[model samples]
Target: MSGMINLIKMELFRLVKSKGTYLTILFVVIFSFLLFMMSSSFGEQSKANMLEEDNALYAEITEEEEHIKSGGIGFVGVDFTRDTDIKFETIVHSFLSSGVFLIFCGIFAANTVCNKYKCGFQKNLSTYSNKKWQLTASENIAVLAFTVTEILLIVFILLIISVFYFENFRLGSAANIIKYMGMQAVLYYAFATLIMFIVEVVHSKVAGITVTCLLSMGFGSFFFNKLDEILKLNNFLVTQHTIVYNAKMLPIAFDGELWGTAATVAICSIILYNIFSAFFVSSRDMA
Candidate 1:
């Protein structure tokens, strides 16, 4: 265990030196803040338009009170702030579940593994006294990378909240954000394992990274939707399962079905990846 811990520390050190790893975090943070600002601006524009429409409608209603008095087509002011409780929850959710962001996560996973292979780190590690300890350390390193990504993500999210809606913040909602980020970390850990499996099987960085991009970018969704149309296997897709889980993690009423599906998919993905990786890494040439 001590050896594995030491290896993890070394892996982290190597990760920091890998410029691509930091690029991933940089991209996620910059794009997340951009999206937040754009969405907030759009929301303000929409609110102004809605307010204008409300005034016009109210004038029409006063001029035509007989219709409203007949209990038909009454105008209540549009509640622009109707869903304010879920505002911050939504900003975090939308950014996390965005197709572009997910693809970046996939790229990050693939690149982390690719870097090890390209730099001959994996081959050297395979020569260690206990191969299992080395592999475990590597996987733990990927997990840690994903955890760090989640931390950066949450920090950016809260930064946005602080800028725009700090007054509306409640401890309960903040707790929910933390909980959702925890779920995201778990999902990303599974994803990193799957990417490692891909990297191992393909034996080429380009192919592995391309496959990761394809899977996370909703091409998988298109194929799976077609399959579901023909055979109803929607729940079996890991990407879809994660999307469902992310959507359900919002500050709203909980749905057992969504959480169950997400949990099942996460567990199955981890188990299957570990099993495949154990066999593939052990039997394949490390050269």
Candidate 2:
């Protein structure tokens, strides 16, 4: 335990002092904010369009709502509001907030692991009286810390927009949001470690990062109306968390809780990532 602590502590010091971790977090925050701000004008136009679509959707539902009420499926006097349609704006808000979790974090964390080789730390670690698991734990801790830092910076940028740009931004029942973010932190470490391990094998940061980005982009666009189909197929893509904007309305969905899906995905991905990482790290000579 003491050795693990020392190992993790050393790893944290090394990562933090290097400034790459901090720069990654800062870049995610600032870049996400700027990206959103630049596109917000178009978003305003889109919002108007979405509101019109929402009105049309609700209008289409009014007759069904009244028919259902008359038939005893609902109370007779409950007049449905035309404004109760799906707010695509909320989803847009979420997307603008989460940023490129897959692409950005995947690149950075993978680099952190690969940087070990570049900086000669992997060679130096051979001289330390440390177990492989302890060292893995250290890297894991370092990656996890930066992951959370990156996510919190994201949340901060969201709050900035919510307070300044929008009105009536009542963030109700945001427990889901927090749960989703916590899940992302876990998932990021798992996927990042996996990429890191692969990077070490490939021994090329550019190639490793390029492949990660390609994979993330490919899987990010797989969402559909059939939730089961979407989630089932999405499970294979560990970085699917990058594109998920919001948890579906709960109490009515299976595999819709970002937390649940994220937990399962993270667990499976982490297991696979760690398994290969273990085999490789233990067997490979330092570069």
Return the top candidate by lDDT.
1
Give a tens-digit lDDT track for model 2, residues 172-225. 446655655665566656657767777856777887788666544433333333
Per-candidate clashes come to 0, 0
RMSD of each: 9.2, 9.7
My TM-score estimates for the predictions, one after another, are 0.73, 0.70
lDDT by residue for model 1 over 1-287, one digit each (tens)? 66677677877776677787777777777766665556556556656776778677556535543332222222211112323454455455545544345556667767776666677766666545346536644665655576556555755765655446544653446666666666666666666677777877776778767866665544555565566577766446433554423422322223577655655676677778878876776665666
Instruction: For candidate 2, list the clashing residue pairs, or say none.
Output: none
Candidate 1 ranges beyond 4 A from true positions: 48-86, 129-133, 155-157, 164-172, 233-254
Q: 29, model 2: CA deviation in Å? A: 1.5
Model 2 score (lDDT): 0.57
lDDT of each: 0.57, 0.57
Name the TM-score of candidate 1. 0.73
- Return the lDDT, model 2, position 236: 52
